[model samples]
Target: MKEVILALITGFIVGLVFAGFKLPIPAPPAFAGVAGIIGIYLGFKVMAWAGPMFAEFFK
Candidate 1:
């Protein structure tokens, strides 16, 4: 997707700049943290999709 590519490119640029300046990268420093963020996003998406379905079912 366009958004995904743009995000990756932007992150790469920021990372390079941070490295050049010897500053810490501003992001989760571990895979588990990244996974948790992804899990949260998925949870939100699932609720968004299911909320309407359940509402219609109960009506």
Candidate 2:
């Protein structure tokens, strides 16, 4: 929870700084981009879950 709050605050500050400079916010501007991020996260989770199983197989 603390990390999440920190990320939110950091993102908010970056968004403001970008806007102040009249630049685009460095965030996904479309649903597709958001979905791609989600997919990457899910893939990482799956790999972590499978890691121990694969390790045992080789031993």
Candidate 3:
């Protein structure tokens, strides 16, 4: 998607800037940390998808 591409590009640029300045990258440095972030995103998306169904059921 266009948004995905844009995000990748932006991240790449920021990474380059950080590397150029010899600064630490502003993100998780390990796979487990990255997986945690993915898990959080998935949790949020799953809740968003299920919320309406639950609301309808309750009503």
Candidate 4:
């Protein structure tokens, strides 16, 4: 769905920002990938929780 796609995109963008800023600590490429994975999982969970609103808006 659109909301899932949007959440994934946003998560990727956030991961990029986190990678750039060195949040928590400086991380290598592998760590950044881990952060991206975490971001994606969290994003999807959040989108699922917000599904009703997104379904109404995006549909």
* C-alpha TM-score for every candidate: 0.83, 0.76, 0.83, 0.46
By TM-score, rank the candidates, best first.
1, 3, 2, 4
**How high is the CA lDDT of each candidate model?**
0.93, 0.91, 0.95, 0.80
Worst 10 residues of 1 by lDDT: 50-59
Shift in Å, residue 11, candidate 3:
0.3
Cα displacement (Å) at residue 23, model 4? 30
lDDT of 4 by residue, 1-59 (tens): 99999978987888888879877533345777889988999999999999887797877
Q: What value does the lDDT take at residue 7 in candidate 3?
A: 99
Least lDDT summed over 10 consecutive residues: which range in candidate 2?
50-59
Candidate 2 lDDT over residue span 1-59, tens digit each: 99999999999999999999999869898999989999999998987999787886657
lDDT, residue 13, candidate 1 = 97
* Displacement of the residue 49 alpha carbon in candidate 2, Å: 0.2
Global CA lDDT computed for model 3: 0.95
Q: Rank the models by lDDT, top first.
A: 3, 1, 2, 4
Backbone clashes in candidate 3 total 0
Q: Residue 54 CA error for candidate 4 (Å)? A: 2.2
Task: Give the top-scoring candidate (lDDT).
Answer: 3
What TM-score, to 2 decimals, does candidate 3 have?
A: 0.83
Error of 2 at 26 (Å): 1.3
